[model samples]
Target: MANFTELINKHIIVIGGGAAGFFAAINAAEMHPGIKVTILEKSNKLLAKVRISGGGRCNVTNHCFEINELVKNYPRGSKELKQVFSRFNVSDTIAWFKKRGVDLKTEPDNRMFPDADSSETIIDCFMYQVKKNNIAIKLNEEVLNIIRNPKPETQNPKLEVQTTRESYSADAVICSSGGHNNAKNYNFIQKTGHTISELIPSLFTINLPGNNIKELMGLSVQNATVRVEKTKHQYTGPVLITHWGLSGPAVLKLSAFAAKDFFDRDYNANILINWTGDLNSELVSSELTSWMKEKSLIVNTPLYEIPKRLWAFLVDKADIPDNKPWNELSKKHLNKLAQVLTNDSYNMKGKTTFKEEFVTSGGVNLKEIDFKTMQSKIMPNLYFCGEVLDVDGITGGFNFQNAWSTAFVAASSV
Candidate 1:
């Protein structure tokens, strides 16, 4: 708990050169003008995630302004983020970027991206801020350990960061090192006595190996309900048939919320898809019954706004003759068709990372960190932000929003 005067001329070290790292370093230096801030990145490239996020557009933040509604997008750290967002929420993020001359545009789904439609716009903004603040960025310098220097009870402790090539000492250390898929990668933070949660993959697409659905790749339904069979997890949104399996916003959201469950099942589970979103068995039956009065071929008359190709596939799956007139459809075939439309089942054998956005559901346990300051409870002068903590959201700009908010808190605190 150093006062403002005590922090004058102090140094701060930020590990990770990704979205959170750059953000923390730049803000820390900008907030306390006398402090020297340095960023240590293990990778050669900086802002790697920011470069590929939102298919290269860099989803900056969600357009959601209400903290209550905005926090819903997060599956892991929604509770903690309630307090965090109160300090720096989506509106703050929008204003922060706008103040820097980067205007963000909202998509139909509320994902906010730079109006320029390029991630480079974000990278350029960060680089400009870094240079403006004189923040030092060292690439390929992997941080291996962080040691807190013993101090008198009256004074705040200092931190010494041990890295691959050399060591650096700082008045405070911000561990915005992003997330790692493997638990062992968090050994450095664990050595400092913070608990690392069981890491599991989140936000992935369901993989159906050897399934006929792959043949209908590139087809998508505007509205479909995908549910993990035998589990209560389900989401209704656009569902896409990919060459690998099923993907889309609904699948990605399901994967995020059920990450631990999917990991427990070893990614082997049955996913029931309702191509007709919100349509129950009775409703589907009614739709099929109403179509019986028509003389057109069943495949030729796609209903419920379903794509023609998918309608044909569903008709074939029900074993009904594609060319059979709707009026000549059998009772048994009608039941089968209703079932196929309302309750299509697929066995998911595995999962594919949703695009290049690899988000995980576990990290340093949230209980050990103060959301208000993004500072570690166990280690003095040590802070954490971004996915390094157990905070993640479903695809959109939510994860990035978490990064900005938590990084802002950590920077302002330091």
Candidate 2:
């Protein structure tokens, strides 16, 4: 181990210039003033995901403070993150930004974004921090490999980072390369003898081609329970009816938890939607019985606070005539109405990933990482953070929170 005096002039190299990369680089330089830091980005653009996250608002982190509850948001690495969050969690992320002159505001859903409500706010803050820290950032410099150098018992191992343009030697290396959909993209890391998990897509919207629900695009149910048929996967929250299919918090969460299942099925599966959130068929039927006393048209009296349009669609689906009076409904009509109200089904054929803010569920295996330090267990002086690791969360700022938390740990350790 190098002593503090020997580490004064140490060089730290951070790979990737995305959210995790910038956070790690900035924190590493800030924490160790004398240490030199450089960021190598394959792309010309820095913080590309930050510029487009939260629909351009850049969800910095979530507002959930309870470490246990926060870990639940992650579909993958929840167990490992339980320990990581204790070190640098959402509160730390907010404080870090606040100290840097960035104030974050929380939305009703608990997503935290900059007060400016623009991703540029985050980009500007990162750029300012990089400039202030005098950290070197090289764009379009793809790292081809990292060659580990053997060292004596008294010294820390050094690393040789070979980028497309040049090679640089560093005392420590932090790999915050973000997630890639293509398995080939991780070849550089694989060459270093680390195992990469099966990369799968997460946080995507289900596509229902040729389904009539596409006609109702733009309609959203505030509280809907969506479940994959014949599977235990289900989530209840706001679900949006997009031109492509279902999106919003609930569907995105379902996609994440069932990402592997969806992949196994080739993205072809039946989804059941409970428009009445937690209400079951019995409850829905009971509610409809009370409405039978009303003399008004069934279509005019939407139940369960369901949107008028969606209620009408469900009524039509149940084969209930638009002009039929509620009191005139027979047992058959009532049964069908309750069934469709609580359990509307749809066939999902494919998926549509949010291109700008795409998230994956797999990367470097978490077992090979030390969550306390964010260091690679298999390699010395090489740390893994951000999406590059096998950790991923559902939408609404959870993924960003993971990036911030893991990056902070990596920076602190490096």
Tell me how far the alpha carbon of residue 224 in candidate 2 is from the true structure, in angstroms, after superposition. 1.0
lDDT of candidate 1 at residue 79, scale 0 to 100: 97
lDDT per residue (tens digit) for residues 286-344 in model 2: 88888888899999888877888888989999999999998999889999999998889
Model 1, stretches more than 4 Å misplaced? 1-5, 151-155
Off by over 4 Å in 2: 1-4, 150-155
- Which lDDT value does model 1 have at 232? 86
| Tens digits of per-residue lDDT for model 1, 42-93 | 9899998898888989989988999999888998999999999999998899
Q: Using TM-score as the measure, which candidate wins? A: 2
Q: What pairs collide in candidate 1? A: none
* Backbone collisions counted per model: 0, 0
* All candidates: TM-score: 0.94, 0.95
lDDT (CA) per prediction: 0.90, 0.90
